[model samples]
Target: MAWHKKPKTNLTKLRIVRMIVQIIMFFLLNLVFFEIGANWLVLPINMPQTIFSSSEGSFFLLQRMLSRAIIPLIPLASFLIIGGIFGRLFCAWGCPFGLFQDIIGLITSWVKKYEPTHSTNNSMRQIGELITGGTLLISTFIGISVGLGNQADVEAAFGSFFEQPWAVLSPAVFLFTAIPVIVYWGVLGELFRIENLGSIDILLWIRLAIFIGAIIMIIYIPRGWCRWICPVGIIMGRLGEHSLIGVGRNITKCNHCGICEDVCPMGVQILSHPAERVRSVHCTNCLDCIPACDEDAMELKIL
Candidate 1:
């Protein structure tokens, strides 16, 4: 009698599960601001809190001779530790902005097929790197001048200088702040007895433009923001370069098919080696490749 091979677990299902959980957590984090300690812990997640401020703090510390507090370091430490072990799984599974991109990808797919070409993907990657570098440079300069030193006056000078550039540039900011404000003021204004929510300003328009542009890009290219312009992603990618945990391929089972590579949103060449740990910094550990391989060749392993 011939033995039948048992069906492999659908890893993509796990990705979906993570997305669902992230969606719930994302909304809760924004809507319900509960404090764990005296510090007002602000959503135990790193992206929403630290991504905007980590670089600024780092640059500030570098510029100042003053002793720094341990409180500020906690977020950066948490992000680095998790990223080093899990290879940016948070970007794929936990980031609210990442989930927003995934939703756009699904919606766009229904209307039209948008598979990114190799050259296009490379160009996008370069653009993302440029944006990340520019942001860091600007933040560092500001931190050095106004965010630290004896001349420091973040409350008075920094706001006038930077003018909330982070909020204007960040999609997460638009989603959590602008969207909520619009909904409350524009949508729920009639329902509730409230006055003077304030009119949308030019900064809000800029945020709207950034938000819309990001959505359009994600629809055309999967994980477009993550691939090209997210400073947080750049930081995480660098930290996760030598991640202890990653996807591995089974050489004996692999049939040399390119399905895994094709399905990869990050454009990682996963099948380049017959069997080896995928150490690509771009690998988000989404495990989409696992379900793509029919022969049960790809597996998530820890070292």
Candidate 2:
């Protein structure tokens, strides 16, 4: 009798290379973003204070390319023309926020017994998108108002209940970094904090509430905050819809086994009427589905 050899499944070196690229890019972009926030922790630059706020000088780096004496049509043209032509591979492969969500999802996965699911109704996602869109629009208005030397509502809003709300609600600085450290120090132990944790400029009660809420959401939902409420995600979702880089599906190689659907962290229906397409605006483009597919049907492409 011939003995059947069991196949060995090892993570490919290519996957390792991709992981390294992802990690390096994640840290590098974040370092850039942080450095732009302040200069040497002493002097500040004229650049935007935060990435997502309507602060004094915030600008999407890519969006700045729109207006040029020679290439006046390039910016908006690229934003609209590039994304639909390609899939949203940049979001999956390069976005730092996506990387953070992936890490948090992994941490929560170990403790989670069952997969968390949610309603995929477009209404919910639309509402989220609108809130995000409105915030950005309002921020831009504030920026113009400030630039024009008008500061009435801005000052009033800051002094009213919002009170440095940007610091407390910012997903970039507070959600991923500040809240976790504070929680670990205050509740779980000193394990997460390795040194003298910097004092947060937020009220203790507000900080405590955010910490508790984050813990509850992580356990109950996979990337709940990012998927449902993050203003950054909302903006990215819009950009991803027409991103120049994206996942291309070859229908000839696909068998529609629904495996990709199960693997998607955002719960997008992969085997649906889109027919060789997954234009899911809610998609973070994380590439979790590519490895899960039995057939070599999906590939990252530049359109």
Residue-wise lDDT of candidate 1 within 1-303, one digit each (tens)?
A: 111122235655665676787787565544434422222332112333332222222222221222221233554555567777886777777666777777877677655546666567557677667765665455556545543553445435555325333444677666755566657668555533445325545565676688899888787778878877775666667666678888889989998777778767788778763367887657788888888788889998886
| Superposed Cα deviation of residue 296, candidate 2 (Å) | 2.1
- The regions of model 1 sitting more than 4 angstroms off are 1-12, 31-72, 147-164, 187-200
Lowest-scoring 10 consecutive residues by lDDT in candidate 1? 61-70
Best by TM-score: 1
* Residue runs of model 2 more than 4 Å from their true location after superposition: 1-19, 30-90, 113-118, 121-123, 144-148, 160-167, 175-204
What is the number of backbone collisions in each predicted candidate, taken in the order shown? 1, 7
How far is 54's C-alpha from truth in model 2 (Å)? 20
| Model 2 C-alpha lDDT per residue in residues 1-303, reported as the tens digit of each score | 111121113223333555677677554444544544321211010122343222221123211221111222432343344344533344445545545555765567657533444454355566557655654455555555545665666646644222223334434445545555556558535533546245533454465676567556655666565566654455556767666665657788988776666766677766663544566666766666676666877666554
Best by lDDT: 1
lDDT of model number 2? 0.49
